[model samples]
Target: MDSSAKPILVTGGTGYVGGRLIPRLLAGGHRVRALARSPERLHCRPWGGHARLEIAAGDALDRDAFVRAARGCGAAYYLIHSMNAHKGRFADADRRAADNMVAAARQNHLSRIIYLGGLGQQNHEALSHHLKSRHEVERILQAGPAPVTNLRAAMILGSGSASFEMLRYLVDRLPVMITPRWVRTPCQPIAIGNVLDYLQGCLGVDQTVGQTFDIGGPDILTYRDLIHMYAREAGLRQRLIIPVPVLTPWLSAKWVHLVTPVPASIAQPLAEGLSIPVVCRDHRIRNLVPVTIMDARQTIRNALARIRQEQVDTCWFDGGGSLPPEWTTCGDADYAGGTVLGGAHRIVLEGDARLVWSTVRTIGGKNGWYFAQSLWRLRGLLDRMVGGPGLRRGRRHPSDLRVGDGLDFWRVIALDPPKRLLLLAEMKTPGDALLEFMISPQGTDKVELKMISRFLPRGLAGILYWYALLPTHRWLFEGMLRAVARKTGLPVTHGPEKAAMTSALECRL
Candidate 1:
């Protein structure tokens, strides 16, 4: 079979880099197979239904599933990473995942594996666990039977990236910032566009096969320099930065957690990585791929423009487990084991389902929750203090939603247009929680809108937490339903009545 004829397999199809790469490959006329844990999450991507693209449901850690997905592919892009896992366990997960990839590559007879790795000296004493794990994965892949192409990069600067977001939030929110010594460490940052170009370029260039290359932009600047550049690009005044040697990476991460949408779990590793200089040691790939490199200023400008225009293709938050909790779909209420506590409020609005649905879809983000604006802000602040996502992440699109898109601190788990939208809370809570909205058409012109909030408690604390907030929850739900009706420009015909959890479950059925 011709090498180009066989589909190219991409491992982290739903990730920040992988998500953007798939569309580019398809545009290049390559047959592409995207491997993801939840195939449903890929269904809403712009290129999700492309004629040349195929999505295979699998996890990189699952050897059997990985092998099955790689069976017929000629070459694979190893974009998978374990940074989203628990702090100390991510390194272990990355090791196991790389082992699985090596076995799968050998068993499936793949010709090449292209991996994107972090940039840092392998033997550097200051190297963080994240960089070490990346280096370890590169070694594991190179030891396999198939040839591997490793492209090492430092911080990626683009809209919707974790690094960019952290930079953006910090600079935008704080005019005067207390700092860490790592802020002065020199580093090279690459734009997402150039990274994608190099990735695609490697596929067709035989010279790139079985080779390792360091890739970065033209400028090598410190974090402080990047921050100043970002402020200039965003039309903001110069920031007052106080660099202190006493602030450890852990403390820096905690500070980032409170100031930005990035949680401590992700910020900590990133913070530790900055302590080491990550300038590119090899420039061989630059000539091999020969693409225009964007400087820090231009990169920040482009990212800001994308954000303002709401054209961010993928986000760092998009990379996580999006599968709905088991209790959400269980047939019986008792099947959830313990009592499932919930509150449901319904209102009959005098409008077509489409009109009501239009208002429902625009619930979060700048639109703001229909009622209790102050309360929402307070909750977001509290969530941030506890290392949660808070409401700062916001939604990808103003009025459109996909299964994996982040809406404030809630993730869209199930979305059905003109009918139902289910969101799972990513905020710190004692129990698992879900907020669901169902719109059912009435006799003729009217539609019944129902809002349900469910909580599967963890233990005694969870139960106490639910009861304490039950009154507030009821008020918020009722007010939100009424507000939605008012926004739809429709008269409320029936009561903003409280319903049972059973009714909410029945509506799903």
Candidate 2:
């Protein structure tokens, strides 16, 4: 197949890399067919509406579904991984997925398969499960009838890359950290731009087929060096690091889980791989691809620039299947009734419901939370310390709220103007949460504003967490509702005055 003909199939369409890669492919004038397990999730992408893009909904493990997605493609990109899939036997699952992909590619008469794997020079037997799974997937793709262009890379520096996010949170949150031995491990990290360039350059490139290239940045640095450089770039003070040998991969993962937005399960494999040095050994791709590689410092600076502008195109959280299987049903919260646990507050205000709704839309982002800006900032900082999105991902637009839009760390799940607005918590939490605001007209010149905070706790910890924050919730939620009322030109009252206002509002109802 030639570059100009046939659609390029992308398997992990909603993933961190694939989500960003599709836009680049579309801009390069190539038709893209993206295969996803949940097509509805793809609709949330900024490039989901591109005319040249086609989205195929199906799981890669389903042979028939996989073949259908790959049928009209000349080449396919196997970007899917099962590491964070929550399935205990991820390696076996990955093997099955790769086998299915190979069969689909062969059945569909595809020309080539391009894959992005991990960078490691260690023997396969000595490599960590994560890196080994990547290598195993590469080998499986190579065994197929079609030639495979495999690009192996280490830590990818970007605003939304998982590795970058983990580093970003660690450096930002900790001043003195007791790190694992891997902190001193030397590695060659690559920028996401360079990685994308390599992936795109391989397409229909004769020299790249049937070849494997090790990709990295212009300079090599230790993991400690990376943290220091990131701190300097972020204008933070030098962070003190004490490397300890006793922190096993499990303990390190738990540490990372507590400090960053990455869950323990996902962080475990990543933390384990850090023990192996990942410097790139091959420079052949640079000669063939004709792309400039940014050094470590420059890459970190670029990622910071993107973060400051809030122009992050995609994030590690964009991947759909990372959440637990039970949490998946939380999407049905819009249809689900009642608050399992949380606070409910209501205020009757003298204003148009539209104006009140408008005020609600501007609650987050640059407008800041209405009642207490510092408190919200503190909450965001604490969330960031615990590996959450914090307040960085602000609203997509200042005055617009839509389903699936990320407002700070909250995702808009239900948006009904002048009536109801619902948000699902995307921050790291012990329980699933849903925050909803409703504005209803009591009569002319009177509107009832209701705020409901709900949480479906996971276990004893989740229940304890809810009750522990009950006092804070009462203070914050009550104040927030009153603040909203004040913003809508309503009168504020307390104690007996509040009781009088409530009676008056009740009469209007």
Candidate 3:
């Protein structure tokens, strides 16, 4: 793409929406510059490798970085919102960021600016702090020298978004939940993909400039209805959600902290805001852009499917290209072989891990390995000569796995619903090997799964065997995780899933 065709500069590109949006910019044949606090931390899945996308270090808060990055750009996308991370004064932060953007855009003589804001009727007094902050940011942007295209959005139902992730974690952890009247409130839910469509559409529409749009998913339903829709689509029974009129936002926030993965800092404002209904009142965006809308249930199904297929192009949390950790609550051992491994994420769903392990554990005589049956039989044959269980023991469960079950040349050592699974290798090796599986919740129902393959080298031969297999580890490990995520879940990519990821920060944002 030519530099002149590059229509705009994108802020919060390291954010959930930005993470996913940058690619569309490239696809639209526009040259783009993305703002990041740490350029080195910028990890773009689809566009990371694209030459059209440039990562420029900048924080919306840091006037210098903001101004410097915005200069010489044709336009700017003010997609950065401070609600999840900045507390109490997120509005103030929003204002400052907006001011900096305005100043920089004006100084750079940019032609236009596009921003994504929350939707609500401000005149009707229907606005939460989140919405209010969004509105405030819009006003600041519009008053600037550049024409502004503001798209106000409703509940986004995609993977990595803060709100989406919060709801997802809450539902998965608490099969039964206490009541909160806010959940009964009505709102509009938009698919993350659809939102991206509008956002990318903003790049070309001259009518969009100086106008505001209210964006939403295809379905308009109460919060509870949305929840029910998500639950049904996730292949689970209707989740138990009890709403109490008496639970104030403050109290409810603490309750949310206990149930969901969202930290109190974000949950407080978000929970309080839930009291206000969020829906698109105008059909402005519909008139301006041509696109298809997805119902609540279909949105849920597609979002989950995307994660399971490892097709989630990006994540809100890991958007900054940050290195995420894999957690295990003990029982990860270094076996006598030369491998290192861990378990699966706990709260996040391993849509396929549960099924894969279930099938692999029933190996022996005829069952064989669910995937690599030949290798399993060969290992078993070698194990038999080495006086190992081989394939003779079969398994305690033909299809189900337990703490003591035996599979071909491995025995189940640890088992936990969702979080973990451990297997001790009984194969003919110079030493022992332990396989630990762990999965972690990342940006809603998405999971970060880590498979640990640990082996302690017995001696020189043991070391050689393990070292010889070291190169194999990369392919096997990457392929295994990718396969599991294809079955497990990737970060939610489109719509609300593309919303910012909120961590359960003990400290305020």
Candidate 4:
């Protein structure tokens, strides 16, 4: 690695693979230039705001954006595709995106392009739309001037990845699942961490530069085996998986959508794609990248650990309202009695705890809460009329907030510097309302943030207020995180709708 060479451009820096890859690139002593249509959506991401990372505000499909981002970079990582777009046009969109990246790389004189494509090959008669598109993208990229390094991977079992989460939700929620017969289809999955290792190792591997490698973990297992493996590790019962051949991919997808948060578009195509075997046919890259690959069981455990921690790396919602609220804890907790109704995201941002706290405290004042302003005001007014602080009085400062500052209808009852802030609702409706924000340094520069919103309903009013506002609250919190990522310029690869978004890998069948 030449220190004097220009930085690397990572398109889809906000995506699943890209999210994990950015950190590696930075850690490898390479400067990172990330392309995103909305860089703000990444503030909550792990690589969001490192000094080594330069976010290039642009979309992959935008020719100008792509050209500008790729200019002078030693290498470019292409990790994006759209299988969730308008009906029947996903492949076209993928081709166009590929064309854009190729043209940009050519015009910008990029040294190399590394792309992670789907692993399994298919006969033309049996190929699915999603896989075809993936293959097409690879071909398009290879035809360009830059030497394209394409790593074909199966399911990536990690936090926020689609195949991993879909399996996780199915296993966690159901003791028995009516799975399609495709459960027996063989596939290989790589741990997220191992995949990152391979990606980082490729940066200087000249032999891998112009090659296509099948990347997977050490073991090959049927989807059923994966379910059992995850179940045993999770300490759950071996799920009674009723595999029926009659259930078409479309029907199976519908089943997944109704039962899990995965959208129908992602599920259906994924279900159809499942009929094919996804086992890795080669181990050439592993020899070169040389990572200690995690087994399927371990991969599932790691994924569950992250999901339970609520630091999911992708969005799993079907294209609709914002993603649902999910949470993960760090090192400590006892469940207290209260109606818990808000989504919590636990992130380890690299900064002093105090700095992170100051950033949070300044939120929700003159700068406004990240999500819904009208909704917040309406709720604040209702609180104010009921003898609450309401929206009448704002916070003391837009940037400098104290522990006891009055923030609209909310009061800062408890404030622990660089560690915690507790807010007690001055509103009159609920029996008692509490919002606690806690931040602790994971390391010298990493801060772990936990926000807990607890409300004890008094009677009818509280219940009505909570239920009526539940839908909006879900969207708001989810979007608020995105807004936070955007505002703070955080580096996140994937998120809330991770499962849904990644579901396209399945549709390629």
Candidate 5:
């Protein structure tokens, strides 16, 4: 089969693996179709505008929509999983999703379904829910009329992978740590590049169809070894790790939540899965797809290199909020009427919308929040003192913003260039907060800039916190808007002119 000639379907196109895979597939001369719940979200991807790529918007659980996306595609990649789902619900959701995909593939007469699952030696009864769910998903995919190629892998060492990010933050933040006994479990991990190679190499290979492969790297190491290796590569001092047998996975997950950028929901399952050994039992994949797998030290070095170059392609947070599965569906709503307090400011600028947006994307880190640099630094210091992320993370690229990219103490939740940018607060706070900027064209020569800061307080403490900072936010945000206008080298419109500009901006959007 000439695989590149037929259109291929890629589900979970907005995720870490899927996002990177699309570009590789495209570069290999394959026509691709991505099935996204909201196709507009895929716009944030680097290859969003590729000529050979088609985006089909629909939910995976909807059989009809899944079938529509699979229509006319030769092969499909199932990279979807509910990492943020509740403990009791994720497995069921995974099963249903796989079943839906199977029905779609059978209905559309697709050649095969390619799935990426977990690597583990434990049987169904011994596996953790997370790993068991992965195995179940693979079985469900194959139960259909189409042949399924399942690739099972353990921790994928890469710059922006979830496992890598968790390790990065934990190792960087803690000098002396208390860990669970499962940290000593043996496992064979794989590098993301090698994993991608196998996925691409399997495309038209007859041996890969309806086959299950255990893929791993050259080195076999424990979680403790992985962390120590990361510290050595990053030039950090040796960390003192004390392991205790009593710390349950739930408790370990909560500890992970407090220390890393990953949330409790996703961390819990990961922590649980650490108890099982995920080593590859055989090297059969080498015969069909030959690729050099790097050792742990080399993998860490490669991941660090990407970070230093500010070239992290996709992060685990790209799909949206870390806490809830439903948060990804909250699109463009700036208002939270009930308990959320909001501070908003709008200004009219006599410059191109593109210039104004360029200014917006470049705020924070060395650029220093555009205005009130001292106040911002002071706040960062206070946050760091309290064990918060502060503003130290800076950003990957000064002028580029992608979903899930870290900017100082905030994470980019949404980015629509020359139009909108939404950031979620990742600092130690009593409540959830979002800072948003919306830029709309006001005729050909002007633009309207709306900056809104919103806080959803947790309780009395959160309520008190919002009101206490209201005055500071008002002053800072108002001045920031003016600074942005200044960056465009444009004059700010006055009272009457502001109204006219607003009218034009409203019409354009």
Candidate 6:
């Protein structure tokens, strides 16, 4: 069978790299099957409905599911990693996932497996656990009967990438900083475009199969160099950075966690990996797959431009369990299941539903949360202190939002323009939560807008957490409703009445 005719299976199709790569593959006339744990996340992608692209809902760790997704695929891109796993079990999770993929590939007789791995010396005693896990996954894939093409890369710089976001927030938020010695360590960073080109190029070049290549940008520099370059690109004043030997990687990770949207779980491994020099040792892949490699300065410049334009295609926070809570969709008695606590506030305004929705969708990000922005910031700060993605993961676009896009700390689980927008809370909480806004026609020139907050408590703490904030939540919701009406240039015709909890259940449909 012709390779081009067979579909290419992408394991992390909902991830930062995989999300961007799938579109390229489709554009290149290759059939793509994107394997995602939560297929709904992929459904919101721009290319989700492409005729040549298929979404496989499955987990890589599940061998049977992996095999099912791999069947009939000419090759597979093994871009899965478990860096966001709870505690330090990411290594074990990654190992198990790789083993599952290997078995699946062997069973399905896959032609090749292309893996993107971190760049680091295997024998380096100071190698971080993150890079070690990546190296281990590479070995496991290569050990399979199917040929493996491994592309090892250092930091990837682009809009919405984890590394770029960390660097961006740190430099933007801090004018003067205390830094770790790793800031001076030499490193080679690659632009996301170059990385994608190399990834797709390998599929055409048969020589790339069964070979390992080190991929990097044109220039090699230190973290300090990246910081200053980022500031220069963003038009910020020169940053003052002080390198200190006393700060360990763990401490550095904690600092990054507080300063940036990247959590400590993901930041720690990255910080540790930066401690080791990561310059490319081999450039054989460069000759096999020629691409105009971008330097760090140009890459940073491009990223800032994208951010300003609000045109980020995919974000580092894109990958995660974004499935709506089962109770959210279940149509049962409000108290039938576990305790679900919620309050709904509705406002009758004299305007078209479209006008109200236009204002509603613009909530969050730099536009602010309408009312009590300082309170929102305080909540975000508290959430960040607990290792959650605060409000830093802003909305992808200013006025438009699709399902699965990150809006501040909330993920858009459901979006129906000019009608309904439901957001699932990503902030640290005692239990699962959802914030939804619904717009409905009230009368001739009137629209009713409802803001609902629901929480399915975990236990006693969850109950306490809800009641304690009951007063504040009411004020916030009512104020936000009035503010939205004002912003829409619509006069409030009636009450900002407190609706029954049962009204929250109406969102199930």
Best by lDDT: 1
TM-score of each model, in listed order: 0.97, 0.78, 0.62, 0.64, 0.82, 0.96
| Model 3: CA > 4 A from native | 1-4, 43-46, 123-126, 319-509
The superposed Cα distance between candidate 4 and the true structure at residue 430, in angstroms, equals 32
RMSD of 1: 1.6
Candidate 1 vs 5: which has more TM-score = 1
Count of backbone clashes, every candidate in sequence: 0, 2, 45, 34, 0, 0
Model 5 per-residue lDDT tens digits across residues 47-122: 8889999999888888899999988888999999888634468788888889989988888888888899988754
* Residue 283 miss distance in model 1 (angstroms): 0.8
Give candidate 2's TM-score: 0.78
lDDT of 3 by residue, 1-509 (tens): 33356546888876668878888888878878888764533442434667777778777888888778876688788888875533567778888989999988878888888898887777656457777878888888889899898887777777656577677767766778776888887788888889899988877777887887888876778878867777877767888888877888777766665554344556676775667777777887787888887777887787777766645544433432111112221333332123432222122233344453443333343555334445556766565554444664444334445343445456554556555666667556775566666544555334545556656556778878877877656555544444443432343232111111122111100
Weakest 10 consecutive residues, lDDT, candidate 2?
500-509
TM-score between candidate 5 and the true structure = 0.82
Residue pair clashes in candidate 6? none
Q: Which stretches of candidate 2 lie over 4 Å from their true place?
A: 1-3, 85-87, 122-125, 321-421, 424-434, 437-479, 487-509
RMSD for each of the candidates: 1.6, 6.2, 16.6, 15.8, 5.0, 1.8
- Predicted structure with the largest TM-score when compared to the true one: 1
Superior candidate under TM-score, 3 versus 6: 6
Residues 446-508 of candidate 4: C-alpha lDDT, one tens digit per residue: 656655555556677887877775666546655665666566664534443311111111110
lDDT of each: 0.89, 0.79, 0.64, 0.68, 0.80, 0.88
Residue 372 displacement (Å), model 2: 9.1
Alpha-carbon deviation at 223 in model 2, angstroms: 0.8
Query: Which segments of candidate 5 are over 4 A away from where they belong?
Result: 1-4, 85-88, 122-126, 322-343, 347-355, 364-397, 403-416, 422-435, 439-448, 453-473, 482-509
Answer with 3 or 5, whichever has the higher lDDT. Answer: 5
**Candidate 4: segments with Cα more than 4 A from true spot:** 1-4, 43-46, 85-87, 309-509
